[model samples]
Target: MHTPLAVEHGANLKQYNTFGLPSNAQALVRITSESDVRRVVDDPALGLAPKFILGGGSNLVLTQDVRACVLKVEVMGRRVLETRDDAWIIEVGAGESWHETVQWTLDNGLPGLENMALIPGTVGAAPVQNIGAYGIELKDRFESLDAVDLITGRSVTLHSQHCAFGYRDSIFKRHLAGKGVITRVRLRLPRPWQPVLGYLELERKIAETGITAPDARQIFDWVCGIRSVKLPDPAVIGNAGSFFKNPVVTPEQCRDIINRDPEIVHYPMPDGTFKLAAGWMIDACGWKGKSIGRAGVYEKQALVLVNRGGASGAEVVTLAKAIQESVYGRFGIRLEPEPVVV
Candidate 1:
């Protein structure tokens, strides 16, 4: 016998992911119980076997055959930990789809996380990337989360401060990308949220009527509407969404590029740095919708590299390299891909 850890193969990964990118795993382990992790980790068939934790696969772009054993976190549970007329605390399993979790808050009439509506990925991966959009970040309402250390098989609690969130990055992303798997995350939300109103699109939305403040649900709906326009429906198109992070450069460096071409677009960061829109750069470099075989940059959002159909991981990587070369050659800034290429 191949043994339990070595026996089963799961669903076609092409459909499990929102990206719809064709990919597969040779051996799959769906982990429902935390204790099952220890058994899988120690399985003789998995002796020195490489391990990976998969959530919604919304943020990851699989680029090749995964020789490693893939663990699908199926842990599911959600509860209202503490609540009152004004304060609400909710805890959710990391396996919960993030978009669903956001919807749950709105349905319950609580007033946080609405601004983060429709972000694709699991709750566990949210903190890993410190997921943000519009004008709010997960860290803003974050309470804490439990993680099972793969090496020690011990569950540890991590507070918001311990997360060390900064611009689409956190502790799990930086140091424990593969070593720690999150079990659950708790978030504290207030009945009345402090409206986030700095994002340009958001500001323009509320600015239309010259409103002073917009409510959480209103802002949440707006964010969802905006993202829908910017990013393609993964069901209709196979894409990993944003292919690169908006490049952040010092003011001096930005000035050099702006001087070279006044048409260059950029946003000023709070840290006195300039966030150059990667999509704008790609489009400016004439790479938007540029196709090399079946892989290409999204026509609407240049930052997203899409698989038109019948595309392989190798083709995606090749297209990305070409885009990088073009952007770097024209602007002297190298575009970095956001997807975890496996």
Candidate 2:
């Protein structure tokens, strides 16, 4: 018989979440392997307790003390699983930093993830939100993943189709939310490496630098530089990146808004709906750099909501709600927050 790992009681979570919200978990266990999760599942005291799977805590807003047992994933490993003429399959542990994984792929000559550089969070959490940046989304490269069901202690492999990815959403955010813990993720980087450069920032980079034909490495560098300028470093300033998702509207609705504000920034999706820039709407409503109870909108980018200092999660949520209302009142489009508010 093996002894179960010791659980940390009253674990302070101030430094866990990127928003720097102050909160505590009643009990927390660090998960370093599949067996660690199984042990927790089979433990009599812990098996029945509700569990919360925490990755890098980059895309979260904790508004209250967590009553659930926190499973802080710390598993770490990365390797090329297989190489084919058409694609390269790589497996990464759940705890690997998303940004570090992107850079590693580039350093190892894997180019499919260049457009999504600098995204915060962990590899395990990527699929949950279907995180995207510049022009590429995690689903574009996601192959499959291994997850352990907390209740059954059974490990299962799920492919992209099973994940049911959507615009910044997946099963992990819906039906499977909090039901399982991801242990490993596999990404399929297609061969014949092609660069993604359709984003406005990348286009501007090309125009400014006069580099019409850039490589994957160049695109990666450009994404890193652009994000650094637009989004504040969580370490220096507390924030969950891109506090809100861009609103997508029908053509009729978009036409109506465009008639009212001709300068609105909008993009046409392949599905015919128009995606309106939430930041632009917030800025148009004059919310840039505004603060309410220690929570403020980023001066550089209104899409981001920041913690001035010693901000409570409740304050962040209140500020977010206020911004949502303002943007809705002005543009008649309700902005949805991107982070999972707890």
Candidate 3:
């Protein structure tokens, strides 16, 4: 039986990620079609332990040689299948770059995805984190997704409710995280657009420009512009954008932190918890631009940890642990990582 597969081991994974850290893979495979995905999974020649789904490779950290086969999804397609009076449901292949899908939505004049612009990674991985930026998340626009279960080789459509979305989390990440690979994702985008200026940065951007009712394309461009300017292009600095997720704490904890430091930036989580910006916490703790050996915190952003040069995965983990420990010690709040360290 003919099959598509990668013919290499100990391949340098540096270029595979935005982080540009040196790592190795035991095996690598790119599946261009839905059948190809199954074929690679069912390959007897390659003893299957488990497999890793490689998407945009932006929101992950390669800390060691992959002990599992890496299946790089190449399935790419996009279509506008349904239009409501105020919205359209767009079906996008899981392998499509999430940003590409966002761009497509804007190019077609869809409005919902404008706030989530410039987040790196594939459409499939978006659900993995229930990815968000500015003020919108994948869950906000999520209609459904189809994924192939590795164990049963069955396709299942998981609706947004089934995805179990939280702050940068989902069922695909929590329960069935490594169980299967997503093939398609459907999104319902707004047509009769409403501007979301809840995020401080976004609101500030629009306020500074004095633009009212900015269209989806302008909002997308503004987000891209802000991110490109504020965030160091990973191609140059070697980093996974935003290394830690914002900590959501109880309302009591929020008040306590506020009492301790009145200027602490905190947002109320939907579940009566207070969400604190991990970047602000880290920056306040003085970790920005701080380097531990070869691994250093990004100078521009406190939330991002960088591989200055010759840093190993273990080293990054160690530094992150230190930051976590330090943050907890200072504020009595635990910091959680945003990237998948695999």
Candidate 4:
């Protein structure tokens, strides 16, 4: 007979979350495989209990100790499902480190995920937020994903259309949140890989390096180099990558803000919407390098909120709210937090 899965009660969660906030799970179980999840589902004690699925803990804000049973995803695998003249289909376990997975793809001669290198999180969590960097987003390369419903313990495969991807938003964050556990993710990398150098920083890299034609590895290295200098390392600083999403606004609203603050940084989206830089707004409001309690805005990037050692999730939330209030008062655009606050 297979050994029973162990549930750890009063599990410390500080080490699990990127923010390093002190919290505890009432009960925690490590789900290393699909069978582990099924075991939890079939168990009489846990079957009907509320659940919280955790991956890399890179994009979360735990405000308090978790009351529901926490299922920590640790499944792992990666392989090329199919190789065609048009494209390559690759599949990876949900718990695989996203950065590592990107590197693995490059090592295996897959080139599509280079622009998204150094993104912190697990493959499973990537789709939940439609994680993006440079000029590429997860939705851009997504093909399909396998997830198991908590209520029924039945597996379902979802395509890109079913994901309902939006800017830092997804169906997983809406209809599927806490209801399903993603098991695997598939990526479709088209043949004749084209580097996404449209982002300003990447263009500057091209100018600085004088390499007009760069390959996938070049773009991956560039992205990693840029992120290393720009974003704080979570291990050292304790932060959720980008605290706030770039708020999208109408053209008229953009014009109104631009007229008021001529120096504001903004980008025009293909949809005719304007995406105002949240970092610039926070910096404009004088929040950069500032702190409230043990939480503070990162000195290097105002978009990041860091734990100034021993910070609680509540302090971070307080600091975020203050920034939001200031930005709204000045620009009339409410900043939405990117990380899911629990």
Candidate 1 on 135-163: residue-level lDDT in tens?
Answer: 67898888899888777777889998788
Considering lDDT, which of the candidate structures 1 and 4 is the better prediction for this target?
4
Model 1, runs deviating above 4 Å = 1-7, 84-87, 209-212
lDDT of 1: 0.81
lDDT of 2 by residue, 1-342 (tens): 767588999999988999899999999999999999999999889999999999989999999999999999999999999999999999999999999999999899888998988999999999999999877789999999999998899999999889999999999999999999999999999998877877888999999999999998999899989999889999999999998999899999999999999999999998999989999999999999999999999999999999999999999999999998998888888888999999
lDDT of 2 at 292: 92
What are the candidates' C-alpha RMSDs? 2.7, 0.8, 1.7, 0.8
Clashing residue pairs in all predictions, respectively, total: 0, 0, 0, 0
Of the candidates shown, which would achieve the greatest lDDT relative to the real structure?
4
Error of 1 at 294 (Å): 0.9
Model 4, span 210-256: residue lDDT tens: 99999999999999999988789999999999999999999999999
Question: TM-scores, in order shown?
Answer: 0.92, 0.99, 0.94, 0.99
User: In model 2, which residue pairs have backbone atoms overlapping below 3 Å?
Assistant: none
Considering lDDT, where higher is better, how would the candidates rank from best to worst? Answer: 4, 2, 3, 1
Return the clash pairs for model 4, or none. none
Local distance difference test, candidate 4 = 0.94
- Model 3 clashing residue pairs (backbone): none
Better of 3 and 4 by lDDT: 4
Lowest-lDDT window of 10 residues in candidate 1? 1-10
